[model samples]
Target: MFCGIVAGEVRAFRVTDEPDGVAFLDTRPVFKGHVLVVPRAHLVTLADLPPESITGYFGLVRRLAVAVESGLGAGGTFVAMNNRVSQSVPHLHTHVVPRTKGDGLRGFFWPRTRYADDPDATSYAERIRSALAADPA
Candidate 1:
């Protein structure tokens, strides 16, 4: 799944200028502004990611978390990941889901949603990308 996105074989609404990873909207989103940041390399889990790459990879995650909040006007963000046990895809991808007060989202068992169409998802991608570009840190 992620391999296809990294290879441009899959159609993903992508956020440009990702430093050490590829940024794109998640197909099943916890919220409207949910984004998935995945390393360019095919690392199956955090254990597979090399030590030297950790900082850069997490730097991108931090930026995306900020971008998701500011871009979507969310109160905050829910940034997390699943390892080998609950891993849906065999890729080390971090999920950055936008959060708002009283949005009814609770814990890891919250429901997910799909964008109405590509245009809708593209709007989110554009917002996050613009925010990411504007972010100097």
Candidate 2:
């Protein structure tokens, strides 16, 4: 993790001007366009982020939801933070997942399946990237 280094790891789907931040659909998403909004800052959870940072973080999440809905044709989106049970990687990040009726995503009610191959992963990533780029906040 690149603490205080803004740009973070992936540059492909970066949305905002914050250097230590980026967002895009997860390569192995739970659904077709499941997006992750992460800060480049190396923090364990949202509680570790400053108030202003948290505010900006969620603002980006909202922008991502709109982009996913308009550009990717998702019926709606889900914004979530897993501070306790599902905190993987120990970073202060949020998920903006696009959802549709009968998409079979049970949210936190059921476990998520990981993608099996690179090609499928790449396709989902590209789809969200294009959508985000076309309608960036």
Candidate 3:
């Protein structure tokens, strides 16, 4: 349970319990209906994951993307995996961010700016949670 995010039982769009670890969604998200497909086993980079797990992980990501796009009404979605360079957490996790025009979020091209405070983070997380709960994909 990293960061206490997994405090109790929660629902996931998809779940794959591998020998090494498990992967699921981030109930709190940056964008509406955003999902984080992560391995429960701690691995810093994609290269560290087992070959079969890597393959299955991406497969789940693809499915999650389709769900986010269809269920969340996103115009598009962004899927990404990170190594040490941009990895905030040591665990290997993939981000499935749902995108829309005029959401005030620029694409990956633009530099990211920090939110004002906890309220901003809470607001964003709440919006995504509500959307996902209302219409899960």
Candidate 4:
């Protein structure tokens, strides 16, 4: 499903697209403006990513974290990924979610909620989309 998003065969509201990877807003986001950064190639796990490509991939992840914070006016961001354990998709992707104090986001284990509706989801995606444009590398 997501590989299609990376391949451009499917439509995904993208935040940043680089030679090594691409960052797009998560359809089911932990928070509004939450984004997922993934490698262009198909890699099941982080260990599968060649050592040489790690830095570049993570560099974009770092940039997205900053964008998540500044763009969404968040106090910070929650950046994480699951390897085979809780990995929803079998691809290597990093989640960068905007954070704020007392936002009810507990630890890594917390409740998940969907956008209020389609319009709400669209607004959240747009917020992150525009934010990415404002904060560039």
Candidate 5:
């Protein structure tokens, strides 16, 4: 689905394009200037990507993070990716989101408002911790 974006055949609000990957403004973004860096070749997950391709692909992601932060005057950037679990597209892409202090983002992809208070938050954390402790792997 996203290979078209890398080939320039798919029109998007482009940020930068390099041999390694393509960086473009996400059509559905959490904020303005949000960019998705996609590898030129179609790789379903990060594990599917060749090890040598890592630096080059991620280099563009790093640069776009800076651009999203400085160009948009954001306090910082949130860089992330979803593997097979939550991968929206079958292609690998990195998300670089512009962030401000009170943007209301909390856990990885969870909205801050999804939780209530400290007790509510503690309950969630405890469950995860218990699961981690029980895991044999």
Candidate 6:
């Protein structure tokens, strides 16, 4: 889906198309002016992104953050990315959501669920710590 959009094979409201990346409107937007920025190359996650491309990739994100607010007359913008966990697309895409005062959009789509107790929280944290320890990268 993202590949088609980036290649112009799919229809999407285009924003900016540069060597760094491409920007376009999200089909299902949080707000009217929600846009998505994606790399031209097929990169699945931030860890897959080359170190040399980091600055360029985020530069485009920074530009869109400003443009969303100025162009849409929004109070602010919510820039987010989901890696493997909540990623809707296998291809990497950054969501640039326009924000305004009292828009009634609550933070985090999921319900506010808490751990059973501190022990449960500690166990979850340990799992992440062990994963990071094993990963040399």
Best by lDDT: 1
Candidate 3 has an lDDT of: 0.60
**Deviation (Å) of 60 in candidate 6:** 0.4
- By lDDT, the better pick of 3 and 5 is 5
Show pairs that collide, candidate 3: 21-41, 22-40
lDDT of 2 by residue, 3-116 (tens): 332444444333344553677546546666677778766777777888878667777777778877876688998888888576765677777877888988773863366656
Q: Candidate 6: misplaced stretches above 4 Å?
A: 110-137
User: What is the clash tally of candidate 1?
Assistant: 0
Per-residue accuracy of model 5 over 40-131 as CA lDDT, tens digit each: 88888999889999988877677676666656567998999999887878888888877999988887754322334445434433432333
Which lDDT tens digits does candidate 4 get at residues 1-137? 67898888888777777887988877777777888899999999988999999889998888788777776789999899999999989999999988889988877765566667767766666666676667666
What TM-score fits each model?
A: 0.96, 0.73, 0.61, 0.87, 0.76, 0.78
Q: Candidate 2: deviation at residue 78, Å? A: 1.3
Candidate 4's C-alpha runs over 4 A off are 116-123
Query: What does candidate 1 score on TM?
Result: 0.96
lDDT of each: 0.90, 0.67, 0.60, 0.82, 0.69, 0.74
Off by over 4 Å in 5: 109-137
Better candidate number, 2 or 3, judged by TM-score: 2
TM-score for candidate 5? 0.76
Structure candidate 1, residue pairs in collision: none
lDDT of 1: 0.90
* Per-residue accuracy of model 6 over 31-102 as CA lDDT, tens digit each: 666678999999999899899999998988887777677665679988999999989899898988778898
TM-score of 6: 0.78
Model 3 per-residue lDDT tens digits across residues 1-137: 43233322544433334333344445555654556767656567888888878666676566667666765678988888779986777767888877887777655552344445556545544544454455433
